[model samples]
Target chain A: MSTSITLLIPLLLGIGGFIVATSRARRFSDVGSGKMHSLPKYHGYLVALSIIVPAYLIIFLWLFFEQSVLRGVIVNALPDALTNGATPAQVSLLISQVQQAASGATFGNPDPAIVEVAGRLREAVVFSRWALPLVIVLVGLATAAVLVSRIAKRFRARNYSEAIMRGLLIFCATLSILATLGILLSLLFEGLQFFSRVSPIEFFFGTRWDPQIAIRPDQIGSSGAFGAIPVFMGTLTIAFTALFVAIPVGIFAAIYMAEFASPHVRGVVKPLIELLAGIPTIVYGFFAVLVISPFIREWLGSIGIAVSPTAAIVPGLVMGVMLIPFISSLSDDAITAVPQSLKDGSLGLGANRAETVTKVLLPAALPGIVGGVLLATTRAIGETMIVVMAAGLTANMTVNPLQGVTTVTVQIVALLTGDTEFDNPKTLAAFGLGLTLFLATLLLNLVAIQIVKRFREQYD
Target chain B: MMENVSFATAGAHARAPEMPVKMFGRKVEVFYGQKQALHGVDLEIPERQVTALIGPSGCGKSTFLRCLNRMNDTVAIARVVGDIRLDGEDIYDKSIDVVELRARVGMVFQKPNPFPKSIFENVAYGPRIHGLFKNKAHLQEIVETSLKRAGLFEEVKDRLDEPGTGLSGGQQQRLCIARAIAVSPEVILMDEPCSALDPIATATVEELIDELKQNYTIVIVTHSMQQAARVSQRTAMFHLGRIVEVGPTEKMFSNPDDKRTQDYITGRFG
Candidate 1:
């Protein structure tokens, strides 16, 4: 019933009802000796909203059930011999075939029982598809007429209109909250299944992280220890190294741009800095692997410092370059937002511009700058493409930036990229790693926000 | 304490007239980009006296104020051509160091702009940059004396380590004053320093400025005619980019030589 009219009839009727309601309200107000509460358009919108919302909801609800009811009738008609060997997925497929065949969609070989059931299912679906839309149209028109009829000289259409607007706004707001909850729930359930096979304690603290477990029970190479400590440490090392490279350079550049750079110099340099940010991270990763790594290795050899060809510094350096624009742009904005009077005060006191920046501008802009750096740090931590391509995928627990290392994100990708049975703990461990990565980034973000908030509170 | 105070007071007056003009500007004109902002203006700022420039909006009073120490040099498009002398030496001379000039001629702006730093650090910043003190104790003394002179020491003494931005608007302005004084500049340029302050804060700042003139040559630009009258010894009224009248504050406010100055003072035209 809901599907037959291609969903346009009810929509048009709803819009028409809205127009009539508003026009009628306007006419009533004109005849009476009173001020019209809301604009005619707003009143019309409110009537339209009422007509569309309920009928749309009813149509959605009917469509959601209509499939299940039709599928059930077809499923019941299938032979027991066919059903015994079939999985739930196959049964659904068979039901779909019956549905299509009934609709005259040239289905392949059908069972006699399916033929009978399919005929009945087709009649019910066709009838409902047509009848349901007509009913909704009638319901919408009747609801709109009723609402418009209530409009009179004293009607508070404006207040009702405002309420509807608020509800619409709230409906939009729920999307993000629901998406976050959905992700957390799916991860939690998957993690639970993985934990059932491998104890949570061993997964967290075991020293070995060899995850070559076979999908079949008889198969074996490495049973795989899923200790996450090394992966976590690697992420930290990369993030910290990247931040060390980025923060000082980014901050100084920001200060120079905001406080000291001449307009001519700023005009030339600011866009170049932003251009660095615009380059794709994947491209940066490619550069790290092909160009930066070899150059760093050469430099290290000259200095008599031996480093693996796949040095962590390779990816870290590229990540830092990627982050430079983020930090500089954000810090520049923060510094610029600091009142000019503060600079004047410092300069008036006979302080040099450098002193003024260090003492006044930097401190004033510290909270905002810190927020930017933290955001960049999180980006570096969860970064995958650069680390995967340049930083070796061997999980080596070392603090040296010159050493090759792999982060949790890379390990998770490696574990889950191949096809494997769901029961295998090796594959399941990827979910656990993902959860940890999510939590660490989330925690850092929460703490950063709190610090920024407290800093803002000081000035406010 | 009272005896010493009186003796200092008497000594201050005796030394006041003995000091010669520290800064002099002749036939000075300032241009921002292609637009001329300051017309030919001649003025002698005594070594230790409050000289105020007063005018309506866009009269170039602030531009004239910035010209004292070459603060206009910070703006790339701003051009100044003419002789500005510090102690009879032309400041516009090629050998001049702007950093040193700015150090000698500190400025306070209309709004309080305390750095987002500890109150102690804010005051120490100027001195530290100039290498004014030998050690921490000497630095502390400079901070204390500067704050005391700005009339902020007593209120902020216990909370010296707190962020200067945490202070009230009045205290922050005074803190800025203290920060400026910490560098021990010969002259102070204030551009409408009290415009952002409430009446009480304005009064406090005005009192501080009055006391400060004994040690520092002061040039203040103000839009408020009443503020110029209260704080200045010599008043210069500017119209457009030109100086309309220059004389003792008393004569300028009571009986101006220029009709425009007179009209501006009477609130007839701005």
Candidate 2:
């Protein structure tokens, strides 16, 4: 039978089971004076689920293990002369040829032993597909019929259904956690591989970052230094410059919006400012390269200072503009959360509006404002598309914003772009960089959380 | 330094002999948007005395007291009509700066709202903003004196640098009173200041209010008639956006002229 027809079998059983369960419940009600413990619909759902869930599980687990089990049995049955000394790769290739032969693809002249095995493989696949749905139908119908026979008024169908639902929700939550753990562990293992090739001390503190590897035995003058100081310095300079532009502007805008603007103006203006965050980063990168770099270069050239078009400031300024909405939105919430009685106290004491804001509201909102600024700094450090496009890949260690620099994310992208061998130290270094960057950001976030917690406890 | 009034002569105010009026209101009315919150009412607050406004909830007593210092100006839709004078000067005139008016007429809120700062800073906030001191030493002197006057210095003197919010409920209310007195305002208004406290804290604040009556003309809005009788020398009863009666605290509590005031104070009906 076809797979769709096999799948429809359980669906039809579920419909038939619903009718049987509901009719049985109604029939049992007529024979007894006792009331039903649950509504008839719950009994119908229980019967239907008993049919579909077990049938689907049988089909799923059979499909998961069918191919590997078949492959292993066929490979073991092959002639020992061809398989005794073959490497794992050759064995894999040989298995594919046998499968292709069974599918009638023209690959090579088939040995007689291989031809026999391919024929057996075709028959086994045909038998397996048909056999699975037969067992599924029998098992599913039995479960549904049994569930209908056992459907009493006291069966807790709703509890069972809700427990299943809760289980599904937990499964979904664990899936995401598993995905994150998988990525982190992969980065850790690959970083260990890279460290085996190059010392970790040199990778962290060395000033040179030449990731070249010699191809020939006699090749000379490719040291492959892998010093990450210049890259770290570049990341810091761009992030600091971004903060220099973002923190003051974002905080001031937030203060004005929360404290000064009337409700009507604030409603219109706040969403407009938050709209900056909704724009895609690639579009911002395009604008940075096309607009801001030229503007900065021309303005600086008039002052007799030669600067590169791809200077770090171009990306840093653009990223800062991108970050303004984050800081402003969070800080606005923080400032607005302050109790109004404090303002009344200040004003009743003859303090002016400016004094009330500076002396009462700002100090009360400091911890949350610091939280906003720290979050914006993390985004600045991890920003990639703008840095990759506008901040050039030259890892210059200079503090001047006019010089070109590259961040860790930018280098990670550059390192992973092309088809490259994973065994080489140069390719492995990306994972090392990724792990280091993740750890650094994690440390920063922990410290920020501590500060915010301490400050909040002090005031509130 | 000043002397306290003896309780032996407290009943003298209940008689027909007239005392001088400090702030006078003639035909005062208040409206919030289209809704009238205060009727056309005439009343007088005596000089250097505690006048308690007693009424049930939503009687407009708080509204009438807020009109004394133009605090109603903060509500955008609120409108006041008629003349209310402070020391015989019209306070609602356009030339009267509201900040200076508030400086002369300080207020303590229903809830203890101390700024998130040290106890010393909480008291010194008024003097710092007004530039009332010649130096740091003078400012410290003013803070200590205000705290002492508010009866808070004995409890919080050792932890002057600690946050005022960390203090107990009654201590925080006393700190707020010190905050108000630090600026040396002539008249102080309190709106249900002891409502958010326990019985012990309420008794302490009532005692403090009576002592504060020595130097400041105080107008307090209260829900408890017993509290008004305990601390106030003069009492005014408000009901349904109008002042029902005004007289000495003893006469108002013992034998009110108006049926509404008599019902409210005698626990007949509010």
* Each model's DockQ score: 0.54, 0.68
Which ten-residue region of model 1 chain A has the weakest summed lDDT? Answer: A28-37
Best by TM-score: 1
Model 2 over residues B1-270: C-alpha lDDT tens digits? Answer: 001212323432444345578898888999999999889878899877889999889889999988988888767689999899998889999888888888999999899999989999999999998899999999999999999999999898899999999999999999999999999999999989998999999988988887897789899999987788778888999988889999888777776788888777767777
Clashing pairs in 2: A208-A227
TM-score for each predicted model, relative to the true structure: 0.89, 0.87
Best DockQ among the predictions, by candidate number: 2
Give the least accurate 10-residue stretch of model 2 chain B, judged by summed lDDT. Answer: B1-10
List the candidate 2 regions with Cα displacement exceeding 4 Å: A1-87, A90-165, A449-460, B1-19, B25-34, B73-82
Q: How well does candidate 2 match the true structure in TM-score terms?
A: 0.87
The superposed Cα distance between candidate 1 and the true structure at residue B224, in angstroms, equals 3.5
Model 1 Cα lDDT, one tens digit per residue, A342-446: 766665555678777877788778888998898898888888888878877787778788888888888888988867666788888888888777877888798
Task: For candidate 2, write residues A1-460 as lDDT tens digits.
Answer: 7888888888898888888888887776533454666567777878887888788888889889999988986798678988999999998888887898888984567788888888888888899879988898789788887877887867776677666667778988999999979988999999999999989999898888777778667998695778888888889888988888888889888988988887789999999999999999999999999999999999999998888877888998999999999889988877887888888888888787788889998899888889888888888888899998898777776778899888899889988898878998888888889889887776778777876677667536
